[model samples]
Target: MRLWFLIPALMAAALGARDANAQQVHFDIDATLPVRDTELPYTLDLNLTAAAPTRIGVGALLDLREIQKIVPERMADNAIVDNCGLQVRLDDLSFQAQDETIGLDGGVTITIFECSRTSERDFQRGEQKRAILANMSTQATVDLRNNCAYFKLVDLTLTAPEAQREQLLEDDTLDSVKELMLAAVDLVLNETPLCPELPAELASLDPVYENGGPKEIGDGGLGVFLDGSVDVSPSTILDILTVLQQRKLIPGPP
Candidate 1:
């Protein structure tokens, strides 16, 4: 990812003012972040302006499929498998961005085995494949301290096919099965931190935000927006110098 930082020339006027504490520097960043090892593009637009408390705003759009890639293909709890008498494996994962939620399609394979048979040999009975659909409401948060973003789950619902729903109810394990699949999805989304590689110059700015960010879901992806600020005081300058020196982008003092 390449980040372009545009600092307005007017900021010099503040630095020259009598009140040093009133001086502030603004930053504008626009960049396209490519998903790791993939050609997919994630757009990011951020703005931090000078104000009484300083203000920052960010907008980002990431393809939903890229998020699917991060989730594990095989996630099965041993206890659940044993109690349910089924071996589960997540075969494929797909996603779609809806009006206010992201839709998930998970292809799952279940192997039914004889629970009564303790023998390791020939205990398998048969296999069945099913498609599970889910819709999720989420919120985005920017973590400048960690230099990353996180998706927080606001709500989740399983929209299973009618036939599968009947089967699930008949099997008397609907709740357990739903819990298992949802847990897998939650693990990948909420627990996993998303850190987009940022240029050292932008990273050194020490971006900060106050509240939960806003997001838009559409165009087959998730768009996250954040408003925050960056300090430009002497301490901030020193931090930038330290970062540049550590990255060997500039010479360090002897």
Candidate 2:
């Protein structure tokens, strides 16, 4: 069957910043993301590639033990999932500051095994909605140049029961759905704003998916190879630092 997957606000709780000591920052966010939209416009397959190879993923995204860290436990609490019995969970979150970019990386796993009904009538009729579980890793870099951001999808692994996998494979539906989901992920990641306007404040720091942004992609493994950049404000660094402080990710002024 043709399915339009409505991805949750995977970009909502994600934000990062850097200081002089780029390697000294740490943040962790773990929660179940709710899927609200079930219908999405299908797109062609993604051609993913990496701009420049880096060995950053070798040891772990970041070292949380040595550096000050922040973990937001309430990010996925308000996600809407009334239609599809779907949930997206993000874990192993970490961030770092490089010479020119702020990197946010984490693992996102989508599971749709649950069955739910829209209303009492639907429940009585035995009508149910379900989703598939997909495990994916995401890396986003905020470009200090031209005030934009870039995103890369890595290690995208889809999982399902043997029966389900076989059925979709036999019908050629699995490949189609996987492609669409990856594209949707890439679109959401690149379109979401990374930096705030000058003189950043809590209210103005709201960065969500918006149009009229620059994006690029290249070919890679299992619909995972992808990358794109966006422009950001100069004050974004400071704003993010302030946000971290406000969110208690880092220690506040004594």
Candidate 3:
């Protein structure tokens, strides 16, 4: 009897120790987006670190030279050439994590300022226009712990304010701005040529159309409300969530 009681106690203590160690760790994530309607394809990669309850950092790399190549030829009328890479930084994160979920106790933020290039045609004659190529990244402070993986980005606001959109178009580029807005949303959602179906509300955003296609309303911006979220996890988390949840991590839903 005495030995049996001692065994259980010892096991409990060992598990608690393991959970603490797993809480803080570093991770890496990468994915490629599909070619959206009239939009260039690109790849995204990032490094991140999590230190307990609310500290997270996301380092990023992006390549968008394709967008620049197409604009000059296709929309020559409202043409301002833009081509460059992007860097998405997300930090100051505060969140709570549970089994297969990480909820934002604090909002996540990602911003890309006026960080793109313009074509020579943009500088010709009385050309007084500048294109602000940016895709603001949203923060993910949602419940994201399931098994040993982190939560994947499932969604981001798919629209930009009208004022912001106008600011992005320099010269004739603005003429095609409405169409490009859909492409911009496609870039963020990693929507490939085979872009997946979005949630219904997102699909029905347009008052005059509903091809389940991306659209713009009132100048806010064009966006792709993704069908789901992103999943991210470091190795250390598995040891902790396993011990804390008192169960094995289930694999993806059948």
The global C-alpha lDDT for each of the candidates, from Candidate 1 onward, is 0.45, 0.34, 0.29
Residue 100, candidate 3: alpha-carbon lDDT: 27
- Which ten residues in a row are the worst by lDDT in model 3? 142-151
Question: What is the Cα-based lDDT of residue 71 in candidate 2?
Answer: 33
lDDT of 2 by residue, 150-171 (tens): 4445424445557567765785
- Root-mean-square deviation of candidate 2: 17.2
Tell me the spans in candidate 1 whose CA falls farther than 4 Å from its real position: 1-44, 53-84, 89-93, 98-100, 106-110, 116-148, 152-167, 195-197, 235-254
Error of 1 at 232 (Å): 2.6
Candidate 3 TM-score over all chains jointly:
0.22
lDDT of 2: 0.34
Which candidate should be chosen as best, given lDDT against the real structure? Answer: 1
TM-score pick, better of 1 and 2: 1
User: What tens-digit string does per-residue lDDT give for candidate 1 at 1-254?
Assistant: 33233223223322333333334333333443333343333445443334433322333333334433443232322222333355545445454445545445544554555445547653444444443442222233333335456654444344445756777677654466556645654555454444444465556556555433334454655555544555556655566456445656557889
